[model samples]
Target chain A: MHYIEVQKKDFNVGYEYQQLVKDNSSDGAVVFFVGRMREFNQGQKVSALTLEHYPGMTEKLLAKIEAEAQERWPLEDSLIIHRYGRMEPGEQIVLVVTASAHRKAAFEACEFLIDWLKTKAPFWKSEETAEGTKWVEAKASDDQAADKWSEK
Target chain B: MITVLFFASLKEQLGCNGISLSGAGINTINDIKQSLIADKPDWSKWLHKPNLLCAKNCEVVNGDCSVTSGDEVAFFPPVTGG
Candidate 1:
């Protein structure tokens, strides 16, 4: 099974982990990633963050990223859950789970999914800092990370 | 008509989220940008910034991307989410 979701409500990490593991008994490895809002970014002290996305495009691009992961790995299933709207520091913002028969495929796929999502996804973030609200800018390091996957 | 969307800093700078451009003579994303700049000369400074990113429909694309009558094209700053 493959699933993708973009929601404003918080999700349960344990429950999602169970859902990815329940039916796929044959898969011996399950790798998951959870991203949380940080209190400090780019020398600013962030108290909260508000996330925005292109409504129709966000879901479409997420599904495309998931499909790419499945094609690159020998996997049993994969899942992606990303949240939008206002979130405080330490709150969860994203989750990715990859289930595969072997450890290597699960590990690589999970990393690849997050790396691609960072640069490819349409989500934008604005942080409430000590000075004021500031829009987050994309970093060159992220693009470099995603570029590594294209290498032979 | 072609729908244009703005996001993040671009939305704040543009002072609007979206606009509909009649497809009469426009054929590409760059054409839409030129029309918008022509209407509001004040926007020329940022509208043509080298770092600005765009998308055709929901896919990330370049300024030369073609557009149809009903396509939803987006203009925004580089993606910052993970």
Candidate 2:
């Protein structure tokens, strides 16, 4: 099963994450990832970050991503949450959790969700820094991460 | 009239979020792009970004798909946040 939500509050991704693994004693492994804002980027001090997203498309695309991960692995459950609006450094922005009967599938699928979410979702980020406010630029690394999934 | 929209980077780059256009035989995305190019040449470089997507009423679409007069067309760059 897949669950996805986009919100603006801090969530215990670990808490809901534990809930996904419940009632499935067969699952031997679960992997979770939380992405937080950083204090520095491209040699600059970051103060805050504002995330812009299409409300409807954001949830739909993420759900599709979770579904793809489930198809590739014997995943018991997957959850992805992305928070928007203004966020400060060291605050959580995204969380992904994957559960499976084995470690490899759980870990790999978790990584895959983060990878694809970066390049395929509908979110944009702008950073507020000491020098001035600027939008974060997309990186070549993100494309490579998303591309790896297609090679499967 | 069809509502032509741009989001995120595209909106900032183009300096406009969206605009109204009179839809006609200009049904496909290609037609809209052609008109936009004629109206604003600066966006030419971004038309072919590897991750750009065109959508009609929030559904992913191709450049040649027919767009009705009252449709909503959106353009956006690749999303890079996780």
Local distance difference test, each candidate: 0.90, 0.85
Give the winner by TM-score.
Answer: 1
Can you list the residue pairs that collide in candidate 1?
none
Predicted structure 1: lDDT: 0.90
Compared to the true structure, candidate 1 yields what TM-score? 0.97
lDDT of 2 at B14: 85
RMSD of each: 1.0, 2.3
Off by over 4 Å in 1: none
Which ten contiguous residues of candidate 2 chain A have the minimum total lDDT? A13-22
Task: Kindly list the per-residue Cα lDDT of model 1 for residues A1-152, writing each as its tens digit.
Answer: 88999999999999988777776679899998999999999877999999999888889999998998888999788889999999999999999999899999999999999999999899999999888998988899999999999773
Q: Please write out the lDDT profile of model 1 over residues B1-82, one tens digit for every residue.
A: 9988888899999899989988878988899999999889998987988999898888888778888899998999988886
Error of 1 at A57 (Å): 0.7
iRMSD in angstroms, per model: 0.7, 1.3
Residue A53 lDDT in candidate 1: 90
